[model samples]
Target chain A: MKTQKIIDLLDEFLGGERIKRTRREQAVLDLLDKLERKERKLLEKLAEPHDADEIRQLNLKLQVNRAHQEKARQALESWAKTGEAEKSDDGVAI
Target chain B: MPACWKSGHCLATAAAILAGAALVSAAAFDAAFARIAAGAAIFLFGMRFMEDGFAALTGGTLEHLLKRFTTGTLRSLLFGIVTTTLTQSSGLVSVVTISFLSAGLIDLAAGVGIVFGANIGTTTGAWLIAAFGLKVDIAAWAMPMLALGVILVMHPARGARGLGNILAGFGFLFLGISFMKDGFEAFHQAVDLSAVTAHGLSADLLFALLGVVATVVMQSSHATLLLLLAALASGQIGFEGALAVAVGANIGSTATAVIGSLGANIDGKRLAFAHLLFNTVTGGAVLAMLGPAERVVEALSAFIGIVDPTLKLALFHTLFNGLGVALLAPASSRIAALLIRLLPTPQAPGLTPRFLTPAAEAFPEALNQALRLELIRLYDNAVEIMAHGLHLHRRILFGAEPLESVVERNRDVVAIDLDSQYVERVESLSAAIVGAISRADAKPAEQAEILRTFQDACLDIVTAVKETKHLRPNLTLYVHHANADIRIPYNAMRLAVGNGLRAIDQLRKEPAEHRDTLELEALRVRFEQDDREMSGKIEAMIRDGRITPRMGMSLMNDLRYTRSIVRALAGIGRALFGEADATHGAAERVLGLSDDDISRLARGPS
Candidate 1:
């Protein structure tokens, strides 16, 4: 209740209210989670390929999965090595 | 005049005589009437400039505040009071609330609460005038303020100009009060208004009527209260008569809100009606209990301390408005429901603009926000049509079910007239949005750019719908084809589009902090690869004689259309849900993956 009162006071006086950017890293985390899930889903679909046509579709989807996963992994590595990557590249991290 | 009403010449002659008589009376009391008239004019003018200046300075800050704070009825009531007291114009608060209502930003209950609080908030103006305006030689202050205001008004910064206008507004208000006080004192010397003051209930009712008329003509309760203060200060009107007039002024202020609602939506109308209901009921109840109310006021004044009559009048204003809020606030929800039942939303056509209203257009911030929300509404409609054209149930498409099974289950083409639906739903709304944007006066360059982006989103949505129309026939024919080769690819296309729709829908629902438009951009890159792979596969099939060239050609064309549809949908998503902050959005755009980068990642683990 005390915290809420402080927030309300700030909100009243603050001219342009915006969501805080303290949680900017959350976008990277969410994307990593989503990419992992997509990779798993693609692997499951490719687990029992019946024909070349089906294999090709699975291959293309796997390629997409790998492309995104690789980008997200690189982003995660850069964030861990130096937080500068996260600060500078919102779109790339995601 | 009554006898001559039927004949034009007689009416004209009667009007001339009445005009002459009024001129003679005005000449007799010219000093008093002229001062009063000039003062009222200046006050109203200052109020207008101040409202405009605040609006210009705040931009969309007020809208954001309203959205963030008005979470409940009580909160909204407090918000209305604070904003109105700070701005010194209940009309500004009322108009902003109505605009929010028309834009569907705040609900009717919250709006009713705000209007209730505004009534109480507006009483603070009377207190300011009574406590300070009557005591000071405010015209002395007006000169310096007006001089400084003119200098700042010439400044290029909007903030400076806003401050200048506010300063000038206070100056003019003080000067107007000074003029009014002088006018009433001089008028009292020439003519004894006390001799005309009648006693009893009839006189009270008559004074209340006079108050209502004065407020209605000026469209400002504060002005009416000031006029009453001047009269009472100079013994032009009795204390009892001033109280009745204050009650009437409260009721009359609702007329401004009603006039503002004329261009608003049903919800705006409901809010306006709620304002009228609260004031009228409070006014009527106060009228019935005027005798007891006066005694209570006198006792409260005595208990507080010995007070001047003007200060006592200010207390009465606050007390009565507070009484109204106490009486109506608890019943605000009931009043909202009653308003809703009284003003049912008209059954609009499928393509009618929900968020676009003339009232919203009056405020540029409201206009831009309304147009964006309307575009979102249009996108929702387009999504429905596109889902149907793909023979997918929107309920299933947007549900938690896997799209692979969902697409297979919805293979049988639903009977739908794509052309008619597109024209009626998508095309008409798209046209309306474009027309509104074109007709809108984009004064701020930032608003113009935002509007242009919305215009682009509209085009992308329309393109997606058109591509769906083109892809539907081949999709419906080949999804269940006997040939495994053709049928499997067709199903792949269907699954791809369904997955795209679901991703964009989820992105739309994702919280701001978690949302990432780069994902959509990445999807666009993936769709490009899919188009290439499909083209190559179709070419190989045709060369191998697994499928006829005609079949291969149809598959190629449909594949291209499917890719177009996906790309268009992704474009719409990126435009709508991009980073809200301009700097952050620019960084995001710059950091977005280009086609070559996607290719390098897709080729291998390197």
Candidate 2:
């Protein structure tokens, strides 16, 4: 998720080093915050002595979260630098 | 065949009939039968006494002898003769050979040679009976021997007590022989085996059957041969019947090995069958050439200036056994091949432990060694799974490639179904170990204790695999985190486990004798040190404002996962590869986390 420090670090390149928050960036933060909370809660709920069947499920969740976090961080960094989020082949700024 | 009897009855019907015959025969040959039965009982008791003494005295040096000196078939054969002579138990010697053979300590040829030599060695009992038992006034001599033997047997020390047992066995054997001799002398007046001995093939076959029945019932060919010899010397049985009985005794001796090898490993079963085959074939050949064998025995008897019929029988016993060896020794390698073909290594579906075969469970040392070997396989599988869990391949960890490079290139996450792997490898192997241990005939509390430790070791490995499975997802997520604050800490955790595992893998490959638990304990200590450094790194990163309080909390929880993976692997290594194991009981405690130390560590966060 995009923390305040990350937002400021991005704004330094996007808005001439000024501390400003755009509506688009705010939406991004809100969505990222919600995702992070959901992932953390899910992780906490999945208890110990994880039996044979449950391990794969746990691994897939962690894998997707990690991949999503990395992709999101990259997009935010690019948006802060060039006033545009990175676009995928489908033209979605993910 | 009877409607009254049930299946799996063994020889219950035959035994009942034998018992009835003995009761019927008692009235006619009452005095002599009484002395012979009492003597045979005493003789059998002495054999057990001597066996216990030898075992207590020698400890585990027999394993060393099997490991080192058995370079060729001849040496192993000599070893068989010498050991059986000392212990007065061919069955014990044969079982030990089978144990060694199954464990791959000695090759199959060496094992075959030893069994053949044991056949020859067992004839020494017949010689003892003939030379000392029949001719000498054993009752008077035995009294002093029993007296001396009791005093020594009462001694507190191991070797001394063992010596006492040997002396006691000697005394009892002589006394038993005297009783049998007197019984035979008395019985000759009432009945003679010649009356029943038919001419030609029927005579040879009938008496051989008698020999087999007596041995099977008594469970001792030595006893059977001794009885036959005493009966022959006292004119109760003809020389031809004695010869047939001698052949039967050879065939009968294999029963012990055969019964023992049941439910044993493939190699053990093969060895036992080999034992049966050798004796059966030898007996057949001797019967085929009975006339020639008798003439040879008579010639040798005259050359040695021996007039006693019992002595001539002893000479015949040695010659026939020697003939068997001479016939089979050249084909020892071929016999091994034949045995292997007859009993191919079993191939159960899925995965089973290669080392924990029924043959390997023939004796305690072999059983323990096989268990250790299987546990090692479990560890190797675990290492592979753990490497995959951390987004790296086993090759990357075990190979010359840098661990960092491998982790970095692991951008394309490899999918590993840990559940399938566990089911196929760990679970199956663990169950096999438990089953093998449950079946292990390795006697006494110490052997059982070793197997228990192995079983516990298997549990530790399974638990280790399970822990790593739990840690996998978190390890994968954090190790490649977006922020350097989180990324660096997680990587450190991964590296800690990776390094420890790699170190242990190297240590595991070391010769079993040199691999020390202390070294494994040191690796574990370093794992703890790595944990402390990671905690400090996380704290410093938080203070620098690189990560939020929430991020720091996640790393803390994830760090515990990483720490656990390392701990489980360490636990496995300590159990499977401890150099100071009881097998090396004779050696001084060198270095390793002593049981107390490991217990303290297990108690948590010292």
Candidate 1 per-residue lDDT over residues B1-606, each given as its tens digit: 111221224334433554454456568867666666665555545544544444334323344466567877789889989988886767657866775554344678899999998988888999999988742345788788888877887788766886787677666655654565555554333322234488679988887887777676655677678778888998888888889989988888888688656645567778888888888899888988999999999999999994799999999989998998998898888989998889876543548788888887777667767877888888888888888777787999999987778877666445355665676688777888898889888754445766776788899889888988888766666665567778777887877778778888899798986675656655555566666777778888889888889779888888878777777776677667776643344334334455676666445456
iRMS of each prediction in angstroms? 4.7, 25.3
TM-score of 2: 0.43
- Give me the runs in candidate 2 sitting further than 4 Å from their true place: A1-94, B1-60, B96-107, B134-195, B349-606
Cα error, residue B554 of model 1, in Å, equals 43
lDDT of 2 by residue, B35-57 (tens): 66665555445544544444343
Please, what is the whole-model Cα lDDT of each candidate in the order they appear? 0.71, 0.65
TM-score of each model, in listed order: 0.44, 0.43
Assess each model's interface with DockQ, reporting 2 decimals per model. Answer: 0.04, 0.04
lDDT of 2 at B452: 64
Query: How high is the lDDT of residue B292 in model 1?
Result: 93
